[model samples]
Target: MKKILGFAFAIALAFMASGCTMMKMGTAFIKLEPETQEAYAKMMDSIDTYGDPAKAMMIETKINDDVTNDDAVEAIKAITEERNMRVTGDVKMFTKEDAAPDEVKHARIISVCNLTTAKVFLNHSRYYGGFMPCRIMLVEYGNGDRFLITMDLTLAIKGGKPLPPEMLKAALIVKDTMETLIKNGAAGEF
Candidate 1:
């Protein structure tokens, strides 16, 4: 009878401790951007679908059957200019005589940026530099499937404490522009 009473007390203490931990976590979470929860939920959903956490952190669009890699690249460039973003860098990966035949046949990463917005973000936090000059990758698999991929910007936009109003607005514009670049690039649309 004494042992049973002691076990009950232990269980009650565990619950209390866990409850306090939960309360602290909830408080911290509430201090983040309002869309943080939604961003996380979408990331979780992506992980479930792709079975890869890295995949969850990106946005990918399959190129249309008629869209050639060159066409897609051109489209991305055109769209970036039309959207007022500058093409900062264009990297063509794995281009060498010793490249493996079985490896990806084509892979290009185009970096785009808006200087003013980038400066704003940098002034806000140097951490933002890691994400500077957003990349749009064009990759062609061995099976002839092509895709345009970019980092998922949602978490960057809402993962931390709420951004200042102007910063948030700038971030959103960048996010939208990136999504547009990929979607239009995949479709070979300018």
Candidate 2:
């Protein structure tokens, strides 16, 4: 009976100490935007589903089997132009000569940007420059699999304290535009 009481006392002390630590951790997140929790939850879900932290932070779509790489690239370009965004850079990272016989056959990175939106974000915070000119990658593996991948923007959109109204609007526009570009581009839709 005495041993059981002593064990119970030790457990209570441990809980008390951990409770203080948990409270401190919780307070550290007080300044984050309310939506930050939801954004983090979504990211965690992605990590769980994909089993890769890098993959969780990206949005990827497999190109349709019928869609050629050139067609997909062209579709992405057309959509960017239609949406008032410019193709700032397009680099072919891997080509036949650059790869081994059993390696990636084709790999390209296309960068798109809206100058006005870019300026808006830069003016708001210089750190936003890191994300400037969003990029979409088209990669075709050796075995004939192809995919379009881009960074997922949930954390950028909601991880910090709430953005100003204008900034939020601009961010959402960029998000929607990128998502459309990837989804439609993969399907070869202009």
Candidate 3:
């Protein structure tokens, strides 16, 4: 049984070496919480990987390849209004031409909120508000490629476990809303 024990130890070591990414990846499913649909997950997986892998493991990321920065912005605006959520904040990043002009072609953060969900999430942990107003990053490459990056909320909001039912529900609702918004925006559709 020494060989079997060794194999198991190796597997455990592999998971631990990756900063617990294996666990975070399944936090929602492990907790039986709602997660991104299969099609959506697959789409995200197929996109061009442009960031640090180590950073990726710590968060939920969704990226779309076909949507332009402008298209994504318009789509998000339409979605927020249709869904009765308010656009909470918009920030443009990495824009100093002298610093790293070509590194970031286009990078804008679009954040929106369903106030009730905000209230519930905040009630669970006021600090959680730091993650507020579901946000998506609209990105463009100097080579003319475009992408929309979405944050998955299940882990940040519900993966903690032992959260109240209302908090979980609110988290799920906002997570679903964020996914729908990104998918629709990325496809250039309403």
Candidate 2 displacement at residue 83 in angstroms? 1.0
- Give residue 88's lDDT in candidate 2 (0 to 100): 98
Per-residue CA lDDT of model 2 for 74-170, tens digit only, reads: 9999999998899999999967745555688889999999999999889988998999889999988777788999988889989988889988998
Counted clashes in each candidate structure? 0, 0, 0
Query: What is the Å distance of residue 81 in model 3 from its true position?
Result: 2.0
lDDT per residue as tens, model 1, 94-186: 533343546677788999999999999999999999998899888876667778999999899899899999999989999999999889988
Candidate rank order under TM-score: 1, 2, 3
Model 1 alpha-carbon drift over 4 Å, by segment: 1-24, 95-103
Candidate 1: C-alpha lDDT: 0.88
Q: What stretches of model 3 exceed 4 Å from their correct place?
A: 1-67, 94-102
74-170 in candidate 3: lDDT tens per residue?
A: 8888988888788988898755333343456667889899997787767767988777767788766565555667765545753434567766666
TM-scores for every candidate against the unseen true structure: 0.82, 0.79, 0.62
Candidate with best TM-score: 1
Highest lDDT: which candidate? 2
- The TM-score between candidate 1 and the true structure equals 0.82
How well does candidate 2 score on lDDT at residue 167? 88
Return the clash pairs for model 2, or none.
Answer: none
Ranking of all candidate structures by their lDDT, best first? 2, 1, 3
